[model samples]
Target: SNYSEEPSRHPSLKINAKEPFNAEPPRQALVSSYVTPTEFFYKRNHGPIPVVDDIERYHVSVNGLIEKPKELFMKDILNLPKYNVTATLQCAGNRRTAMSKTRTVRGVGWDISALGNAIWGGAKLADVLELVGIPKLTSTTPAGGKHVEFVSIDRCKEENGGPYKASIPLSQATDPEADVLLAYEMNGETLNRDHGYPLRVVVPGVIGARSVKWLDSINIDSQECQGFFMQKDYKMFPPSVNWDNINWSTRRPQMDFPVQSAICSLEDVNVGRKGKIAIKGYAVSGGGRGIERVDISIDGGKTWMEASRYQKPGLEYIADEERSDKWAWVLFEAEADVHSNAEIVAKAVDTAANVQPENVEDIWNLRGILNTSWHRVHVQVRH
Candidate 1:
C-alpha cells in the first residue's frame, strides 16, 4: 500500500481510498461545530506522506530571486512571531461527487465534507520574506517575479515520480492581508504527521493545493511553477472540451474559488410531525471575500428564507476583525416548516455578490475541479 507509513486515521471519517489516503467527515459531523476537531478534520493526500523521523532536524530552504538563500531549522521558526489564523482548508475536488452525477469527471469523488476550518499557529509568510532580506515586500519584485512557488517533500507517482508542487501570484503572496503562514501548530496543538507535522504553508482564501503540505522549499519565479500540478492539472475547462479535444494551456489554474455552500443536515425523515425542520450547513468564499448571506429553500428554489450566521461557539462574531477578512467559514441554520416531501436547497452570496450556480450541469467540467453549485437534499415527511 502506498500509505503504509501513514498514521492511523479517525474511524469516523468516510474513507474514500486506502492508499494516498483520502477521507472526509460525514455531513452531520462536519457542521456540528464551527471549528472542526483535528481528529475529525478531513484528510486529503495526493501522495505518500513523507516520513520525517526527526522533526528537529527538518529544515526548509528559501531561495530563488533572493539576495541570499537561507535554510531555517525548527529552532529558527519558533523564534519568529507566531500568528494564529482561523481559516478553512478545502480541497479543489470538494463536492466532485455531485458533479459526477451530471457528467463523467476525473478526480477524487469528494463530498462536501472535504473542507474544515481551524485555528492555525505559525509565522506569517510576508514577515518571513522580510526576515530573509526582502526589504520591500509590497513594492519590490524580486527579478520581476510574477509568482511564488512551493515544493513539497512527498513523492507522487502521478507526476511521473516527482514531489508535489504548486504556486500563487507574487502580488497575493506579498499582500500583508493574505495571512499566508508557515504553520507549525493546528487548533492549539502540534500538527500530527498526517497534517504536515513540522511545518506547512497555509495560503488563506486560496485553493488548498496552493497551501503545500510537507513544505520543502519556496521560490520566487518570473513565471508560474512548471510542475505538473501547476501546468497540466488543477486547471478548469469548459464542458465542450473533453478528453478527445482538450487544451490545458488555454485554461488558467484555479486560485480563488467561487462562493460555495452545502446542506450538512443528514437526517431526512421527520416521523409523525409536520412542523419546522432544522437545517444547518456551512458557506465560504475565496480571495478575502466574506459571505454576505445564505438563503435556504424548501421547495427547490421557489421561495427562499435567510439563515442566521454564526461564527465561533461562544462568540457570536469573530473577535479578531483583522483576521476575519476572509479566512474562516460561517455556519448557518434555519427552521422551516415542512408539510410534505420536498427538496431542501441552499445558495450563498459572497461579499463580492458572487452566487453559486443553480445546477451542477451549468458548472460541469472535465476534471471536476470546482463544483460549487447550490447544494440540495431531499426530505421525507413521514406520518
Candidate 2:
C-alpha cells in the first residue's frame, strides 16, 4: 500500500480522520480566496495513495469498446492540446455532519469546507477519446456502450483492498460542455501527490467521487461500473427505509447534486454605526447549472437580502451558445441591519430555479447525503 509514502498534509486543515487522510480547510480559510490554494484544497481519500516514483513510466490504459485500445504515457497526454478549466469539486457527503445531527448516518463526518474551486490544466477527455478511435458523439453513437468507467491506481479497503473504481454516463463523458479532463496541473502548479499527481480525471460539475484520483485506466462499457463505490455506496434513500429494510440495488447512485449554499460569517461582529451587519458565504449548484442568486435571511426567514456574487478574476467557463458552464462556486457578500441577536440563514437558487430546502428534516435521507438545506447560524450582534 502507498500509505507509508503519503506526503505531509497542510496544518490548517481540520483533520477528520488520520488513516485515510480526510481533512477540510477552516470556513474562514475557504472563503478567504476566490480560488482555493492547492495546499488548502480539501483532501478526501478512501484508501492508500498510490506512490508514483517515476512519472515517465506511469501509463494510463484506455480500452473497451474502442477501435484502438492504447496505453497513454505522461508524454502522450502532455502532447495533446491543453485546456484550462475552473471548477469546484464537492464531496457527496460534504455536509454529512449536519445531517448526522438530525439522525444517525454512517460515513465520514465532513464540515462545510469539504469543497474547493481551482484552475485545472489538462487535455480534454473528449479529445483523448476521439484520438483513441472513439467516434465523435452523435445521437446514435457510443454504439458499444453507455458508460465510461475510471479505475484508480490506489488500493482501497472499501473495495475489500482492491483498486478504487467509478463511472459516469457516456453522455457526460463525451459532452463538450462537461469539460472532463485528464488533469496534470492544479491552480497553475504541477499536481502534488496528494491531489493525484502525474494524472487524474477532473469531471467538473459532478461529485468529487466521480473525479477519480491516481487514475489508472479508462474503459467504455455497456453499463455503469459495478465497483463497490459505484453500486453499493454513494447513494441516497428515502427516510422511510432503515438499515434492515434498505436494498442498496433499488436506489441509483447520486450524480449531479442538488442546489446548495453555506454561510461563512459565523463569528460575532459588531454592527457598525451604519446599522448594517456584513454577511458573506459560498453558494453552488451541480450539473453546470450556475447559482442564480443567494438569499440571506437575518430574521429567521421573515426577510431576505440577496448577496453579490464573485469568482476568480479573468477565469472563463467552457460553455456553448445555449448556456453558460457554471461549475465553480460563487463567493457572495451582503450587508443587513441587526441588533442584539439574530438567526442568520442562507439559501441558494440554481439557474434551473431549483431552490434549497428551508430545513434539513424536509429532505433528510437514510444516509444524510445531499443536505442542501438552508444553512443557519446564530450570531450575537453588539451595539
lDDT of each: 0.83, 0.82
**Superposing every Cα of model 1 onto the true structure, what RMSD results?**
2.3
Q: Compared with the true structure, what per-residue lDDT tens digits does model 2 show for residues 148-261? A: 899998887879888888998877777766889999988878998889987889998888888999989998888889999888888988888888998999988888878888
Q: Give me the overall lDDT of model 1.
A: 0.83
Candidate 1 lDDT tens digits, 1-383: 26678898888899988678899988888788888888889888888888888877898888887777789888888888888788999888999988998889998899888899988889888777776676534544656666778889898877787888898876677766788989998887898888887788898888888888898888877789988887888888887889989978887888887788898874433343667788899999998799999999999999999999987742334356524436789999999888988888999999999999998888889899889988888887777
Top candidate, metric TM-score: 1
Off by over 4 Å in 2: 138-143, 267-275, 314-325
After aligning candidate 1 to the native by TM-score, how far in Å is the CA of 372 from where it should be?
0.9
State the lDDT at 364 in candidate 1.
89
TM-score of each: 0.94, 0.93
Q: RMSD of each candidate?
A: 2.3, 3.1
